[model samples]
Target chain A: MRTCLIVDDSRVVRTVARRILEELQFSSREAGDGQAALAACQEEIPDFVLLDWNMPVMNGLDFLRALRQLPSVRQPIVIFCTTENDINHIQQAIEAGADEYIMKPFASDVLQAKLVQVGLL
Target chain B: MQAADFQFLSALIKERSGIALSSDKTYLLENRLGPLAAQRRLNDIAGLVAQMRSVRDEELIRDVVEAMTTNESLFFRDGKPFELLRTVILPRIVAARPKERPLRIWSAACSSGQEAYSIAITLLEEEGLLAGRPVEIVATDIATSMLIKAKAGVYSQFEVQRGLPIRLLLKYFAQKGTNWEIAPRLRSMVSFRQHNMLGECAGLGRFDIVFCRNVLIYFDEPTKKGVIERIAQVLAPDGVLLLGAVETIIGLSTRLEIVPGAAGIYRPVGSGPRAAVA
Candidate 1:
């Protein structure tokens, strides 16, 4: 099965994302924040990452930058899932190597659509 | 069973439900009706046929027909049609409609109501764009059992797990023991009824969008043509018809034309009847 890492501070969000990803036949692991997510990626890179923008210790953009720099890490599909809906923020995330952006509190279908758009689904 | 017996059952199904069964479908008929025969205390399919010949058991016949009707369905079964609805069709319909005109959607052969529910969710999510426009979704099936399950809006865990996103599932369904029941809001959006495609549909009135998906493959050419003609009659001139991905009205109906840029979508021809309802 394809592996997915769900990086979100909220346990509920992570659980929900994981459930959806798993439904799409991907095995998933979760991290509460970007710092934990970076460490997890270091241990073993995942095929896909459902990353959230806001988190304690290390934010998503920082994690993405650090992740892209790691020689051990291969290219992985990264989707930003957050409440930040502004164009500027979204453009920034994309510039920082986010593969796609999905607004917070999106339905499973919407997430699935984004995955389809990114060719990860 | 003998060839005559197979012929008898196949003809009966065709007459009653417009479902064409070829000789190769003998296995399908036997497989589907085996348990029904056992339930009726018949020895086998031949015994079941003998019983049918002896008595006018309307209920038994209905059960046989229902058993043969395919109830296969999934929430958002295909992604493209729903995507077209979200991006292009809904927006165009919304823009073309006069203010306060109701949007009527019909889900024909709506097995177990998943397709209808999925449409309702799509509409509900677009409430902002609708700007308080009234939306009505009518879900219909030939089988009473399917309609019952649909009306109850209760689904097994396995059912919801198929093609249903967790976010919408959590939002619209509440746990009922091991199964999940659709939330009252989403449930209320759809009204389930029993309908036959071969029968007159005038009583159901007209619709802006009709989803008659995946049901036509069971029909022969004449039956398919007749059904499409009736569907066109009840469709608003600007209304769209959605068939199963592989199903088409190409040679069946001249009353409609395909919607460009989308597969399996059609609209009534220019000379067709005007809008029956908003």
Candidate 2:
């Protein structure tokens, strides 16, 4: 089965995302912050990463930059899920190697659509 | 609501609009019309139905029909058709059309104008391919309320987030309070009109492409065939018709045929590449 690493500071957000990802037929792992996510990636790279914008230790943009540099043959597709709706944040996420950007408080269909857009689901 | 009331309202809706509600849509009637009834100071669905039966209030009838018609839409609702337009359809039309005659597109049943505006955005992005040729988009719906909203070009935060990418949203829309309003340039490209699919299409003129997506499913078989036949009449010799992903022309019309390798895309019969452009 395809796996995903969901990195978010909030446990509630991580739980919700996990449930939605499972419904989409993906096995998932959770990380509280970006630093932990990096460690998780080092342990075993996932097929996809649902990263948050703001978190302690390392932010999503920084993790994305670091994640891209990891000398792995198979790179995980990063999707930035956050409350940042502005163009600048989106542009920054794209430049930092995020495959897709989705706004917060989205329904499952919205997330599913983004996954489909990135050819992940 | 009583079964008779449900029967009356559903029949009334079908008569006015081509939308055919099934027996299982009782909750739909109550859910949609309940608020409408409250707004109009009617006691309940019963009062609403009684009012319609006794009085010949065209405005009330129109409101009921509009309420029942689903207005759920998002920008670039399905991404595939827009991609097809950008790559395959527009290029062909632009190559064949005369310089003086602008390429025209019709967004039939364009609820709140997303489909029409999406088409406009596609044209704007392909400015290089268009080579300075003019393009016009006519967006029409049976509901005047939807047409008014479409003309405004304002979308909620949720609506904009559905299928619209951040790049296009940032480029084409300006933030207005919590909602994003489409730029004036994009808004100017489309003209909104109150039109019924069952009515005459001659007034709308010929279209190089027609997007009649997701609306025909609500219609019965005969109504679906009638609508497609009418669209075929107004379509240019090489015009393309894009339906919803699930919609097809099979067993519906002899006037239209599905374009192979392109699901939900259709063209008028005998209007192949060899046919001269009118």
- Number of the predicted model whose DockQ against the real structure is largest: 2
Q: How far out, in Å, is residue A118 in model 1? A: 8.4
Per-residue lDDT tens digits for candidate 2, residues A1-121, read 8999999999999999999999999999999999999999999999999999999999999999999999998999998899987767877888888878888878888888888878887
Worst 10 residues of 1 chain B by lDDT: B269-278
Q: Chain A: TM-score in each candidate?
A: 0.95, 0.97
Docking quality category of candidate 2 according to DockQ thresholds = medium
Cα lDDT of model 1 by residue, B1-278, tens digit: 78988998999999999999999999999999999999999889999998998999999999999999999998988767887888877888888788699999999999899999999998888888788998889998889999999999998756775666555766688776657789899989998888998999988988989999999999999999999999988988788899999998898888988766578988877723332212
Candidate 2 local distance difference test against the native: 0.89
- Candidate 1 predicts chain B with a TM-score of 0.96
TM-score of each: 0.75, 0.94
**Model 1 residue B276 distance off true place after TM-score fit, in angstroms:** 15
Give the runs in model 2 whose Cα sits over 4 Å from its true position: A69-74, B275-278
Scored by TM against the true chain B, the candidates give: 0.96, 0.97
Per-residue lDDT tens digits of candidate 1, residues A1-121? 8999999999999888888888999999999888899899988999989999999999998999988887873778888888875546666887788877776656787687667756776
